[model samples]
Target: MVELRETRIQTRQRVQPDDTNNYGSAHGGMVMLWMDEAAAMSAIRFTGEWCVTAHVDGIDFRAPVPSGDTLYLDAYVYDAGRTSCKVRLRAYHEDPKTGSRTETTDSTFVFVAVDDNREPMPVTTLECSSEESEQLRAEAFAAFEE
Candidate 1:
């Protein structure tokens, strides 16, 4: 079994001019790309196998990340099935100077563990040993239900 916290992944990317849209904010596509990469890392950590994205749940952009801000991405495996892992991903915009952060986007993604031959493989069960991990799992499920 893999503990939920063991699969948690966090990454930061500086928003560059080329990564922004005409509105001078981070492009939705660019943000989604980062989210996918972070989620894949989390799934691989949990499953100990190469995983491919199976589906992305609805992604909602709550705020814009300006070009000068740093994008903070967090991903973790909140649930798992025989072959698939569901990851909860969130992005936040942080001001480099004051270190203030605001949530920019959130979504969920599903990934399937695959073998060397690219065939789907069973994944070990996910466990939540800490109270924080258990709360995170419950929150993830609640968000999915909404």
Candidate 2:
């Protein structure tokens, strides 16, 4: 029963002379880095114990965000186990002037709580009380299947 909420992360990096590939877009690794950070934040909020990324189940680059575009990441924890939490992350490109948004990438990641020795630590049950929570739970399941 992880407590999940919409979390945001922003990073601005220009499509520098050296940052672009043949396509002149931000590298895939750069996008993934932001996604991981966003997911980690959600996981930490859900589990008080230190969390380590157990696995990144799936990362789909739905669109390419140009290097000059600002990347916005939204993440939330939707499910939890005794020691693991599932976080859903979405990356979008925002037009600074018009404030238009286009989703670029989305992924689901799992993190496990660990002690100082890096052993798995127990986590409390998640509490889902509202209709939104129920919808999130359903989405988490559908994402897991994908």
Candidate 3:
């Protein structure tokens, strides 16, 4: 009974002096923040109400994003439950001059809808209407674990 939607966002921030550690690289938490923001947007779009981060399944930092790179984030709600929506997020690091991109991290976050009284609310059903959407559905199902 939960409606699901998909959304995406992109960000590029230099590993500024404040955004990095002594190693001159972005912190894992900072990257997660971006991912969370993007995923939350998708959840909200799907539910049309305030949503809360019920859980973060996990985050995998597959590659390192250096100081001067741009971080790109893509997030979408690919699946839904009665009151919960499952979202997939992917982060990439891009070189400005070379226009090269590398995937840095990817994760799935689950969000719950909250009404004005902060009670759990049901979301609408999700529809996959295109080849791209079907592909996303397959990928989501493949990633789903029992």
Quick one: best TM-score, which candidate? Answer: 1
Winner on lDDT between 2 and 3 is 3
Clash tally, candidates in order: 0, 1, 4
- Candidate 3's TM-score reads 0.88
Whole-model lDDT per candidate:
0.94, 0.74, 0.78
lDDT of 1 by residue, 2-88 (tens): 999999999998999999999998999999999999999999999999999999999889999999889999899999999999999
- In the range 55-92, model 2's lDDT, one tens digit per residue, is 99767788877767677777777777788978877788
Candidate 2 vs candidate 3: the TM-score winner is 3
Off by over 4 Å in 3: 1-6, 9-14
lDDT (Cα, 0-100) at 88 in candidate 2? 78
Q: List the residue pairs that clash in candidate 1.
A: none
Q: What is the TM-score of each candidate against the true structure?
A: 0.97, 0.83, 0.88
Kindly report which residue stretches of model 1 are placed more than 4 angstroms away from their true locations once superposed.
Answer: none
| Model 1, CA-based lDDT | 0.94
Model 3 worst lDDT run, 10 consecutive residues: 1-10
Q: Report the C-alpha lDDT of model 3 over 15-127, residue by residue, as the tens digit.
A: 66576667877788888887888889888888778999999977888887777777787777888889888888878888878878898876789999999999999988888
